[model samples]
Target: MFFSPAQIYPFPGTSLAEDPEDIQKEVLENYAKDLPPIYLDVVQHADLSTLIWAPLMFRYPWNVVFGKLSKQNITVAGDAMHPMTPDLAQGGCSALEDAVILGRHIRTSFVQNGQVLVLKNLSEVLGKYVEEKRWHVTLLIMWSYISGWVQQGGSGRGMKFLRDAIFYKFLFLKMVKYVNYDCGKLDF
Candidate 1:
């Protein structure tokens, strides 16, 4: 089974902390106290002067799921296949890439397995899927790690500077590789 929560957002850091007075200062700065009843209701539940802090955690189950659909056995894209830090926003994009790659691999697998696939050929099909997906998926996975590290201030100053100076530009080029996606156009 696969699960994707709707509440996940980009992690600014592992956590945010503020003293009671500072918390009030921020709340006032954000103007949440005047927004509406729906917003103010959350404040009504507790003292506005309390020390409020929210901690962020990146949790990835990284589980694999597969099923056969009319001779097409495959998995759903997303945290089900590869769960990455939300800092990159690529978790979903990575899933899309997985679905594309998997579809391509399955089609090729069927062609190689002949009209009737046997138990022995199952390994061959799955193996090919892994082989084909490894490098491309790995590139995205590494990017996810780098993006998260930089976003959370975990990266060193030099790395952060480099990202600001060069990697940001590099990202646009990378987008081309991702956007020109077509399982059918791929050259095996």
Candidate 2:
């Protein structure tokens, strides 16, 4: 049986002194009572003692992420470019796509001359990568934030009902169709 994990977000932040086991116990207590056997089994088998904690933070005004995609010959990818909430689970997938797309552009542009390294062509090639990725990442950031907002329980009952009944089933599903994209093969 498939058991989708649920998280209650915007939780009070964890401190260095907080024990992972304690946190795990609290989390399980909150949900285990209502979960089915499969979920309880997962909780039982989980080694919460080894779990590492990190802040669940997202960058607001996503333009900041887009704005820094490319500068001179350097460009950011993955979490460096778009630090997003995990609601959509696209963060790592998008990063891997970025690498492939960037590699393709670099191979097609800079390596065409058979030169090992071409400093002059670097900027131009990286610019193309940024151009191709900027809008896509922007869309990802915005949608991820919206998805998180809805899942975390929106402003009120009306908003929650709209998100769950209408937005999630219709608009969000359509948006997700665009996420399963192919960056295509890098022929090099």
Candidate with the greatest TM-score versus the true structure: 2
- Stretches of candidate 2 exceeding 4 Å from the true structure: 1-8, 11-21, 31-54, 64-66, 154-156
Model 1 clash tally, residue pairs: 0
Cα TM-score per model: 0.49, 0.75
Q: lDDT of all the models against the reference?
A: 0.53, 0.72
Tens-digit lDDT track of model 1 for 31-123: 586778886666545575655666434443332222221133443355544555555566666666666666576566666767455655565
Error of 2 at 146 (Å): 0.6
TM-score of 1: 0.49
Instruction: Give model 2's TM-score versus the native structure.
Output: 0.75
